[model samples]
Target chain A: MTAWKEIDQHVKVWMNYARKLILAQIKTDVQVSTKSGPNDLVTNVDKEIEEYYVKQIKLFFPNSLILGEEGHKDSGMLKHQGYFWVIDPIDGTMNFVKEQENFASMIAIYYNGKPLLGYIYDVMKDKLFWGGPACQAVYCNNEKLNSPANLSLKDGLFGASCPMVLRNYRGINEVISKSSGARIVGSAGIEFINVMSGKLCAYLSFLRPWDYLPGKILAETLGLIVKTIDGEPVNVLSSTDVLVATDNAQSEIFKIINNY
Target chain B: MTAWKEIDQHVKVWMNYARKLILAQIKTDVQVSTKSGPNDLVTNVDKEIEEYYVKQIKLFFPNSLILGEEGHKDSGMLKHQGYFWVIDPIDGTMNFVKEQENFASMIAIYYNGKPLLGYIYDVMKDKLFWGGPACQAVYCNNEKLNSPANLSLKDGLFGASCPMVLRNYRGINEVISKSSGARIVGSAGIEFINVMSGKLCAYLSFLRPWDYLPGKILAETLGLIVKTIDGEPVNVLSSTDVLVATDNAQSEIFKIINNY
Candidate 1:
């Protein structure tokens, strides 16, 4: 068995370093570029942060396979026999470029295809929600977080993607209308933190691997459900329509999605 | 004209006191009640804060007229001959009860039927966005804020009430689709802050006097437009469909709303 405590300490140190670098760039001119379209944005800072994590992981765990959002996918490196790491360098790149707030840095670790550890760092707020299967508990900064209540669709607020709601994709409008309200924070990691902290009951969006990986691990550790909208297991290797919610909310949401 | 600097100092002191009272109640259980529906919430803290402000206002400016969200409307007091204070003790009460963040305490002061000063206190973050016609500039905490860019509707994000979007009220869905995206922060004060800070280009909602008064004062001072959706003036004494936005965004949004 790995020394999980020692690994946690090391990861926290690197994450704090990453936080410093992120804070230093806020309000300064950042070179932003389009990814798929004008709405999809990526920045030089995102690439720099991803490269920093890849270098740190290789230095500390030399044999680890790495997957990053900023084009670091090397299928040949995936032996699937040892440790693996997924990094999102900067989640909510649009919010990062626009508001300079509400974005996060995320990392998830796996061992032999099993989830091991995850971290979602809200760099602007100086909060790191981290934990994993090995620890069996999630911590926000220093406080161990309690699992949110298993609220039904009517009992709590919902978060969803704007495009999905505007288009009423897969009946998301029906799902959101039943809740207290809908919130669109524009950051999947921040939305996940809302679910984990009980601020939101569920977050539904079509997300890429690096966008949902760390949030999924951290959320699942707190007794929440993280799965595809179709009630299928998340592939972890491909993009999917994702739903992260408390148990009761997931059951309620599943009924709506299935009916559609 | 009215010892504006001295009054500003006094208001800041009272606002800080109110902030302390609010922070103390967070994370602790408080009685919650419905105002119009389950989605429209009011808490004991809301009532307490409103009463606290009323008491302070009476003690300091004994002759001032007060209009508050939690039933402090006395039409007889509104002769438009002296000082009038409008207050929304907790602008986003649902958020305050559910998330304990994103809510704001708002106050607007009018002298002889003209707006004199306004304050929007983001209680949790300790950010007070305050200014007035007398001051000629708004301030976030201590620094004077710059006016946000006059971006067109297609250039920035938009915020709106959930029901409005779900029902496509006034063609908001079409307007939102034309923007970069939609964001729903659930607080008019926070949404106004976003527009003033250039994070969101526009915010649309049906708002009461206390809900939009302070934000309107600050936003107008920053050169943003605050008007009824029908191109009429917003009455300071009643509820109306209000739209607050940058100049360019307002022109674009007006076309859509008028067409609908």
Candidate 2:
């Protein structure tokens, strides 16, 4: 078995270094460009940050497989029997370029296709929520995090993707209305963080691996359900509609989505 | 003139005191109740804070008219007003009771029907965005704030009340889709703050005087528009649909609403 505890310690150090670099770039002018469209943005910083994390991963775990949002694609490595890192350098690139807040950097690690460690860093707030099976505990900064209350849809707010809500995809509007309200912070990692913190009962979005991987690891560790909208396990190698919620919330959301 | 500068200075002191009281109550168990419906919330803190402000206003400006959300209804005072203070002790009371953040405490001073000064205190962040015509300046905390960029609807995010958007009132969904995205922070004061800070292009919602008063004063001072959807002035004593936005965004939003 891998020394997962030792790996967690090293990852924490790397993430701290990554945080410093991200903060340093916040004040400087960002070079922004669109990927899928104008609404879908990617920044030079995203590329640089992803490259930085990949470099760190490669240096520390030379044979590790890497899948990153900023165009690092080696899917074949996922099939290898070794450590694998899924990283989203800057999760909310649009927010990063526009609001300069609500964005996050996330990293998830797996060993031989089993979850190992996860880190979701709220860059602006300087909060690092990290943990996994190996660490045996979920934490925000140094404080251990409790499992979110199993709030029903009516008892808490929901986080949703704009396109999903605007289009009312799979009855998102109805699901949202059943909740206290909806929040759209435009960051998958931040949305996941909100779910884990009990600030949001659930977050549903069509997300890629890098977008949801770290959140999935951290959230599941805290006893929150992270799965596809169809109540299936999330396939961390493709884009899919994902739901991260407490037990009651997940069940309630699934019933709504299924009925629709 | 009403010695507006002196009044501003004193209001700041009262606001600081109010801030301290609000912060102190944040950690205590809150007594929550509903108004209008379950979605429209009120807390003991809201009542206490509004009463606190009213007491200060009555003590400091003995002849001032006071209209507050927490049942300090004295429309008669407006008629004989030397200074009218419109206050919403906790503008996003639901958010306050649920999230404990994003809500604001606001006070707007109008002298004989002319806007004089406004204060929107983001109690948690400790940011007091205040100023008006008499001051000839707007500020977030101590720093003088600049007018937001004249961003068009397509260039920035739009803030809308949930019901308005869910029902597509005034074609809000279309208007929001034209913007970068939609944000629903559930607090009119925070939405106005976002527009002034260039974080959101506009905020549209049905608001009473206490809800939109402070935001209107500060937004206008920053050269942003605060008016009704049909381009009429907002009536200070009644609930109406209010739009707060920069020049280009306001015009673009108007065009979309008018077309629909």
Any residue pairs clashing in model 1, and if so which?
none
lDDT of 2: 0.86
Residues A3-58, candidate 1: write the lDDT tens digits.
Answer: 87877887888888888888888778588999898889999889888999899888
lDDT of 2 by residue, B152-233 (tens): 8888988878888777898888998888888778899998898898888888999888889888888988888989999898
Docking outcome class, model 2: medium
- CAPRI classification of candidate 1: high
lDDT, residue A244, model 1: 97
Would you give me the overall lDDT of model 1? 0.89
Q: Give the number of the best model, judged by DockQ.
A: 1
DockQ of each candidate, alpha-carbon based: 0.82, 0.66
- DockQ, computed on Cα atoms, for candidate 2: 0.66
